[model samples]
Target: MTTNAQQQLQRYLRNARYEVLPLRGVVEQVRELPAGTTVTVTSSPAKGTEATLDTAARLRDEGMHVVPHLAARLVRDSAHLSDLLARVSDLGLTEVFVIAGDAERPAGRFTDALSLLRGMEEIGTRPYRLGITGYPEQHAFIPDRMTIQATDEKARYADYIVSQICYDPNTIASWVKSMRARGVELPVYIGAPGSIDPSKLLRISMKIGLGQSMRFLRKQHGVVTKLLTRYTPENVFDELSPCLVDPDYNIAGWHLFTFNEISKTRQWAIEMADRLQEVPA
Candidate 1:
């Protein structure tokens, strides 16, 4: 018989969202995913918000449920925000993820996710579903107290929270527990790295300032050696699966950071889902 944990894991895998970048050949790779998959388009300082929206629009046209990131630092002002919101409304998109962005300086009035969220409310053009970022591990620049406070404040306007990618299951579970203790009731979607090259993953993780998570990986016996080959989230998932059945955690599902390795990640998700189904219920 399938255990409760197994059933939850299966359901999470089936409904997981795939996060993709707005880069070359991404659309083609996304086409390989199952029909109506939720595809999140990321915004970056280099590519700008237009790239993210354009990619999202294309994917939506191809019949995928697309959620584009709106980087606060990149938005020029209220006019720009209105224009972007209009475009999104035109596309009939009901969801979006807002981030403070990686840009060194704010382009205009909005400097953080909270301000942008308020700005959206002021203009009366907010999406039906808004996602805000959460950090399980301490951020490189933002202090822990501030991160927690900001999350508590943003929770009022957001429909959900998507945590930053963290490899340690204990840390993730503890963070979720803490969120509940603090009364932030938004459903969380755990951010996880998809099946990808270990070396590349490490480099990207470092670049994105996942210092504590990187340290945790280094402490694992033989984990660094495994970096020469491929890496998977099986260990993390196995350790975290039990939490999926816990009501207080309210972990809605996984948000796989495919990093544009859609083919490999999609295959991994499919195989895992299949394996879960094979267990007798």
Candidate 2:
């Protein structure tokens, strides 16, 4: 590889972060990560917002910087938001990721990420950093225009944007450019799946769509010798290397979706970091 390209790739890997679902045993999985690694725990309808906070608290106690997803729809009102923020402050958290959440109905007045972000300031202790979501590909339910508008609105309140998982590197690269054209300049954390079982990834891709399934297969062709075996993010990272460090893109780093496969993902990250260090940059 060219020296410039190799240097960019190394920079991206060095700043990589991971996202984890709030599921059972997830805390133990997170303990495997190196101390100081930034971990963002996701909130889901199944696990609830408390689960996300609980996981983040554990990670914090483990000496890692934790960014918990505080889903707006799940929060009941200003009182609830205040309590959550106080808890976060007590834990010494400096960052959070806000989302509209997957709940079918809002639990209180705040229904979107922007509303919640505004509420965050009202709580008296604002996190040092806040993140909102971006979608490179169209969201499953929301229209493209609406999503763009929401992003633009939320960007004002957010320090950064974590993109929804998109498999195609070219699509991600183009989307980042479009975001800048639309005047949203928040640094983007590109989301990619970690070292997950191929079968699980396929099931998820199929649920997303046949087109995404095909793209996943094609993208993994270079990384997975056998289709049903374990899959890593090497191909996606390699393909995205250039855009990741390009000044025009305003790219930050990775938000690896570990899917609770933290052990394998952590090992893969270590191996990749070692390999990058061995390279003559």
On residues 105-219, what C-alpha lDDT tens digit does candidate 1 reach at each position?
A: 9999899999999999899889889999999999989999999999999999999999999978999999999999999989999999998877778788878888888777777
Please, what is the TM-score per model? 0.95, 0.88
In the range 1-281, model 2's lDDT, one tens digit per residue, is 67776666665666578888888788888888779989999887788888888889988999888999999999999999988888888888989999998888999999989899888777765688998989887777778899889999899888999988777788788899999998899999988888888878877665554364355666666542365364568867878877876788988888888888988887777688778778776
RMSD of each: 1.6, 3.0
Give me the displacement of residue 180 in model 1, in angstroms: 0.2
lDDT of each: 0.89, 0.82
Q: Point out where model 2 deviates above 4 Å.
A: 1-5, 121-125, 206-231, 277-281
Residue 213 error for model 1, in Å? 0.8
Best prediction by lDDT: 1
